[model samples]
Target: MEKNYFNLLQLPVVLPIDGSLLSLHYQQLQRQFHPDNYATAPDNEKAAILQQSASINAAYQTLKDPIKAAEYRLSLEGININEEQQTIHDSPFLMEQFMLREQLDDLEHAQNWDELTLFYDEMIERKNQIYAQLLEYINQSHWLMAKQQLYKLRYYAKLIEQIELLQEKQFNL
Candidate 1:
């Protein structure tokens, strides 16, 4: 059986998890599973410890990130969100995405600090709103709606990454 990340991390398997608490739990697990402590053990024991350590690390990584946590949660409910096969049929969202991308392209050329900051803020707001809806849908057991929100959230995340890269370039140059 696939390991339940929430259970492994001692989390409640809920959205909007406490990041600091998660980090605390992760640190405790790391200390418990650190390989150096088992160096004097037999080879088979060492191998098993290593596997347990790896599983702990994987669970931490997955549960630490909101998107990954949501994906894992959905998978647990048997709703596999296949990015390649799943199509977001919301036309308005698609149109908004195109417009946002167009704006981003123009911002790339213009390199206006104020505009870039505004766009970044806008993306953040959109991401927050989507996350709110995602939480609502998930709470209500609206799996499909939550899945669609997750897809939209991914796009906003990419936009945020691009904006941050642009900001980094500006800072360096």
Candidate 2:
């Protein structure tokens, strides 16, 4: 049986519009539906609990992350995004992704920690700006604009991963 997002989210249909509050609701659902809690239950009950837990986890993971949430919302609108089968029509976003990929490649080969730090700082600033725009777009019901912002968010998320790797290298050396 497919679970409704509202049920998986463990939230009322008319949940608060606050993102932070939604995150808290996701945590609450995690506590309630986590598979560990069903370890001692009957076999049939455990099976049902595990299935529900997986659905809850999938829902929370998508909803708590801005990019995933936007993508999920788009899917609901029948805007499918299969990276292999579907092409993103946003040329500017594609260009930005290419630029970011080049910068990440350059950073990977750079010997100077200062350069990496500078790049990390720039990406963080961009992320914050995008996040602010995301909040505004969401409030204004600009779904397309919010989806565009989410594309930027994905770039920042990858940049964060790169920064973490660089930090680890610095700590080890």
Question: Candidate 2, residues 46-160: lDDT per residue as tens digits?
Answer: 8988887777778877776656766676565555544454444678877877887787777767756778788888888888888788767766777677666766677688778
lDDT (Cα atoms) of all candidates against the true structure = 0.90, 0.71
Task: State TM-scores per candidate.
Answer: 0.95, 0.67
Per-residue lDDT of 1-173 in model 1, one digit per residue for the tens?
86688888888978878999899999999999899999999999999889989999998888888998888888888899875777788999989999998998899898887899999998999999998999889888899999999999999999899999999988887
- The TM-score of predicted model 2 comes to 0.67
Residue 63, model 1, lDDT: 84
lDDT at position 136, candidate 1 = 89
